[model samples]
Target chain A: MSELGFLFAGYAVVWVALGGYIIAVGRRQSTLRREIARLEREFRTGE
Target chain B: MTTVSPGSTAQPDATAAVADGGAGGGVTTAAAAPLPEPGRTLWLDILGVVAILSVLVALYGAIIWAPTEAVMGHVQRIFYFHMPSAWVALGPAFTIVFICSIVYLVKKDLRYDRIAGASAELGVLFTTITLLTGPLWAKPIWGAYWTWDPRLTTTLVLWFIYVAYLMLRSSITEGHSRARLSAVFGIVGWIDVPIVFMSIRWWRTIHPTLVTGEGMNLDSSMEAVLMLSLAAITLLYVYLLIVRVRQLDMGSRLDRLRQLSHLR
Candidate 1:
């Protein structure tokens, strides 16, 4: 790859890694919240 | 009514425990209430905002404010991000794992283990960034994507060590046992960090050593940009650490609730 190509690729990797991590964490947070809610509902209804 | 401080080890009162008080009723009791979700505080909001802004500023300084190197040209620009990512991974991320692991061993508090686990995850993440970016920068300059050079090899080893640390944490079922075992692994794994830092100096390698006994070899403007990037990345790591620790704490509470519900 050319120098410019290499430069862009490096920056791209950084952005993608950081962005993907943030999104993953956000999704996990949502899943955990949903699970907690479901469990709470189950407890409340005596199911 | 209990509020969770983001990284605090304080156990939240479980509704399942309350429900279990009736012994055989399961959830038939009227006293059982939903556990409060870990809510975001105003400080976390400010931290999120500041981390984003600082990263933006660091980006601008890296791409525009800094001068292009006569030798490496635009590709040298990658150093700003590359060095910072490496620093964060090796410096704060793994170091926190080391410290928190020791604390967990001493105090036997699972909160410290959670922090250690969260930091190790981020450490792997940033190390991945470093490994990927290093090869990209190397391909155009070193003419090879990878080599068996000491610095690179030690860094790769460092990454695998922490990856193993995380995997060890996941393999165990019980909390205290997992914390105890992983704490030992974490402490031992940290021995590799300093080796990675010193690999270039200790051995023959193509990897460039930017710092010396005197100082970093970067030009003044380049140095400024690098510093800004370091600060930005550190802030980002801190913000993420707090957020992840909070999530882990909540997950712990949920696990306890599930266990109690099972006993009913």
Candidate 2:
């Protein structure tokens, strides 16, 4: 592979890793939100 | 006051008790206080944006501005961001270790524990990025993707240790016990970071030792790009840390609110 090809390949890998992490963060945020909503529902019902 | 169970007595207040009971049948009370209101923190956001721009400039500079090395040729460009990322990963890991130490020493509040957790999570993310990118950079330069060199081996160990730290925090039901034990592990694991650096330096290995002012010499433009990328990644780290901390704080508050609502 040409040098430029290798460089671009490296950049692509970096971006993929970054994108994967951002997605994971988003998933965690959603899960936390769901838990919060569940708690809120239970609290309201108990009261 | 009515005679409360050991678990119920430790709850924050009536509101928190109701929320706790409502949320789960047998959830224990936590010592976490109601989260303070988060003020507008534009500094992190601004820094993140600036860092992104700086990284862009660095990328362009590395590829277009700097002259190619006599030996490594085009592949040498990867070193600019790769080394900075390795440095950036250390920043969060060190922060996690420092905060964990403070939390253990003070023991007055749970904020320190939360900070330590946030930093650990961020550290893991950055470390993973470093590990992944390093190999991509290495494949072309080092002629192989994986190396059992001292630096690489120690880095993998450091990454796993933090991964275990997160696992430890999640496995236990949230409370003082989890925080205390994790705090100990966090500090202990951090000892390996310095060992990793030292081992890489003292022993001969393929891992580039640019920081030692050694064989690998960067041109002026390459140096500028590297410094800029480092600054940008550091800003990005700070931004992520703040965002993660806010999320944790919100989750804690939501728990408390749910408990309080149940009490009412």
TM-score of each: 0.81, 0.75
Summarize candidate 1's per-residue lDDT along B78-183 as a digit string, tens digits: 8899889989998889999999999999999999999999999999999999999988987876577887666677779899999999999999967888999999
Question: In Å, what is the interface RMSD of model 2?
Answer: 7.0
TM-score per model (chain B): 0.79, 0.75
- Mind giving the per-residue lDDT tens digits that candidate 2 earns over B137-223? 667766777776666766788789889988999997656677787888887778667877677656755556432324467777677
lDDT per residue (tens digit) for residues A1-47 in model 1: 67898899999999999999999999999988876665665566555
Question: Whose DockQ is greatest here?
Answer: 1
Candidate 1 at B124: error in angstroms? Answer: 0.7
| Model 2 pairs whose backbones collide | B15-B260, B18-B259, B18-B262, B18-B263, B19-B258, B19-B259, B19-B260, B20-B259
lDDT of each: 0.82, 0.68
| Each candidate's DockQ | 0.49, 0.39
